[model samples]
Structures are given as C-alpha cells and as structure tokens.
Target: MSEQRLIELEIKIAYQEDLLQELNKIIAQQQHQILLLEKTCQLLHERMNSFRLENNDEGNEQPPHY
Candidate 1:
C-alpha cells in the first residue's frame, strides 16, 4: 500500500484504541457503582433482618394489616 494510505490506517487504528480505552474506563466505573449498590443492598437486608428479630423478641405482635 502507499505511504499515505498506511498512515491513514495507522491513524484509524490509534483512534479505535483511544475509543476502546474510554469505553473500558466507563465500564470500570459502572462496575464499581454496581459493587457499591450491592453492598448497600446487603447492608439493608441485614438491618431488616435485625429489625424483624427485635420485633419478634418484643412479643411478635401482628401488624394492623394482619
């Protein structure tokens, strides 16, 4: 291939690499957020279980809806 064509191809390849890097960074950030959310959910679940146990200890009264 001609030198100009080769240079153009190289430029295109470089742009693609940069784009790929940006996408990877975005994905990493999203993964981190997901992990944080999962931890929060786990903590909430634990808290709810503790609350339920506490309520049970206090006579296990039925709710108004029951």
Candidate 2:
C-alpha cells in the first residue's frame, strides 16, 4: 500500500478505538442506573405488600348490622 493510504488507515483505527472507549463508558453508566432502578422497584414492591396486608387486616371489620 501507499504511504498516504497507510496513514489514513492508522487514523481511522485510532478514531474507532476512541469511539469504542466512549461506548464502553456509556454502557457502564447505564448498567449502574439499571441496578439503582431495580433496587427502587424491589423497595416499592415490599412497601406495597406491607400496605396490602395492613388493608386486609382492617377489612376484617363486620358491617353495622352485626
């Protein structure tokens, strides 16, 4: 290959490497966000279950006709 062609190829490879690094960082950040969201979802699910149980206990009251 010509000298100019070789330089062009090298430059292109360098750009690709930079892009790959940036994409990797973004993926890592998204993974962390996903973990945080999952934890929040679990906490909300637990809270909802507790609330449901509390309501069920209160629901045991008989009507006024008793």
Best TM-score goes to which candidate? Answer: 2
Cα lDDT tens digits, model 1, 4-38, are: 99999999999999999999999999999999999
| Poorly placed runs, candidate 2 (over 4 Å) | 62-66
For residue 63, what is the lDDT in candidate 1? 64
Candidate 1: segments with Cα more than 4 A from true spot: 60-66
How high a TM-score does candidate 1 get? 0.83
By lDDT, the best candidate is: 2
TM per prediction: 0.83, 0.88
